[model samples]
Target chain A: MRIGVVTFPGSLDDVDAQRAVRVAGGDPVALWHGDHDLQGVDAVVLPGGFSYGDYLRCGAIARFAPVMSEVVDAAHHGLPVLGICNGFQILCESHLLPGALVRNDHQRFVCRDQRLRIEDATSAWTGSYAAGQEIVVPLKNGEGGYVADEATLDALEGEGHVVARYLGGNPNGSLRDIAGIRNAAGNVVGLMPHPEHAVEDLCGPGTDGLGFFTSALRALVG
Target chain B: MARVVVDVMLKPEILDPQGKAVHGALPRLGFGGISDVRQGKRFELEVEGEVTEERLAEVRQIAETLLSNPVIEDYAVRVEQ
Candidate 1:
C-alpha cells in the first residue's frame, strides 16, 4: 500500500512517519502542506510537530493549509486519515473530529513512554489490534489536554468512537484519560501520542506502534 | 481606515494553565485579592474602508471561524474608537 505523509512548515515528524510506513511494508509518499494534491495515496498520515510554529493555536493555523482542505474533503469521503500529536490538533481544528486540545493542565511540556489501551480496534487505522489491547508509545506535547462539552463527550463514549485511552495515568489531563479517538465513520483518527516514534524497538518504547501502520495496510487490502 | 479588535478567551469551564501560572505569580509580587486570571488573545485588524455594521458582522464571522475556536473559546469583536 502507498501512504502519504504531509509536511507542514514546522512539521518535525514527517520523516519518522514515512519511516514507520516503510517499516510496516508500505511505500511512503511525501506530501506538502501548501499543495492541494493528495498524490492519490491509499492513506495519509499527518505527522507530529509544531506546525506553523504552533502559531495562533496548535494546529489552528496549519488547519488552513491548502493540503488540509483536500484532507478534510477526502476524510469526509471515507479516506483513511491518521493524525498524530499536532496532527491530532489539526483534525479537531478542521472539525473532522470533535473536541479540542488545550494547554496541558500541569502547565508543562511532557515527554514519556505512554501506555494506551485500544478501546476500539475496528477503525481503519486500528484494525491490527484486538479490542482493549495495551501498547506503549512516546507521548510528547505542551498542549495535549483533550476537552469537549459534556454532551459530545457522552456521545463519543456512548457511540464507541473513542479509539484509545491512556493507561497508568493521564499524561496531559485529557478528559476521561482519552489518548486517541476516531470519527463516527471510523475512517479518521486523532491521537496525541507519537506512535511513529515507537515503531522501532531500537529507538523507542518498542515495536507496539507498528500495529497502527500495519493496521492501515490490512484495512486497505481488505 | 478603521481598526477592529477581537478578544478571544477560553471557555469558563475549561482550565487555563497559563492564566493559572500568572495568577499564582501575582501573590509573590505582592498583588493580592485577585480571584483569578484567565489569559486570552486580542487581535486588531485594520479595515481598508469605513467600519460599517456589515463590516462588523463580517469581522464577527472572522472572529468565530479564525480568531477563536468555538469548541474551546469565545470571542467578542468591536470597532476601536
Candidate 2:
C-alpha cells in the first residue's frame, strides 16, 4: 500500500513518518502542503512539527494550506488519515476532529516515553493491536493538551470513539487521559504522541509504533 | 480604509495554562484577590474599502471560521476607526 506523508513548512516528523511507513511494508509518498493533489495515495499521514511556526495557534495556519482541503475532503469520504502531534492540532483546526490542543497544563515542553492503552483496536489505523493493549511511544510537545466540551467528551466515550488513553499518567493534561481518538467512521485518527518516532528500536522507544502503519496496511488489504 | 479588531479567547470551560501561569506570577508580584485569568489572541485587519454592514458580517464569518476555534474558543469582532 502507498501512504502519503504531508510536509508543511515547519514539519519535522514527516521523514520519520515516511521511514515508519516504509518499515511497516508500505510505500511512502512525499506530499507538499501547497500542492492541490494527494497523488492518489491509499492513505495519508499528517506528521508532527511546528507547522507554519504554530502561528495563530498550533496547526491553525497550516490548516489553511491547499493540501488540507484535499485531505479534509478525502478524510470525510472514509479515506484513512492518521495525524500525529502537531498533525493532531491540524486535524482539530480543520474540523476533522472534535477537540482543540491547548498549552500543556504544566506550562513546559515535555518529552518522554509515554504509555498508552489501545482503547479501540477496531479503527483502521489500530487494527494491528489487540484491544486494551498497552504500548509506549515518544511523546513530545508544548501545546498538547486535549480539550473538548463536556457533552462531546461524553459522547466520545459513549460511542467507543476514544481510540487510546494514557496509561501511566497524563503527559499533557489531556482530558480523561485521552491520547487519541477516531472519527465516527473510524477512518480518521488524531493522537498527541509521536508514534513514528517509536517505529525503530535503534532510535526511539522500541518498535511499538509499527502497529499503526501495519494496521493501516491491513485496512487497505481487507 | 477601515480597521477591524477581533479578539479570540478560550471558552470558560477550557483550561488556560499560560493564563494560569501568569495568574500564579501575579501573586508573587504583589497583586491579590485576582480570581482568574484567561489568555486569548487579538487580530487587527485593515480593509481597503469602506466598512459596511456586509463587510462587518464578512469579518464575523472570518472570525468564526478561522480566527477562533468553535470547539474551544470564542471570538468578538468590532470596527476601530
User: Interface-residue RMSD per candidate?
Assistant: 0.4, 0.8
Worst 10 residues of 2 chain A by lDDT: A194-203
Model 2, span A97-169: residue lDDT tens = 9988988989999999999999999999999999999999999999998999889899999999999999877
Model 1 bad stretches (over 4 Å): none
What interface root-mean-square deviation (Å) does model 1 yield?
Answer: 0.4
In model 1, state the lDDT of residue A106. 97
The sequence of per-residue lDDT tens digits that candidate 1 reaches over residues A78-165 is 9999999999999999999999999999999999999999999999999999998999999999999999999999999999999999
What would the TM-scores of all predictions be? 0.99, 0.97
Residue pairs clashing, model 2: none
The model with the greatest DockQ is: 1
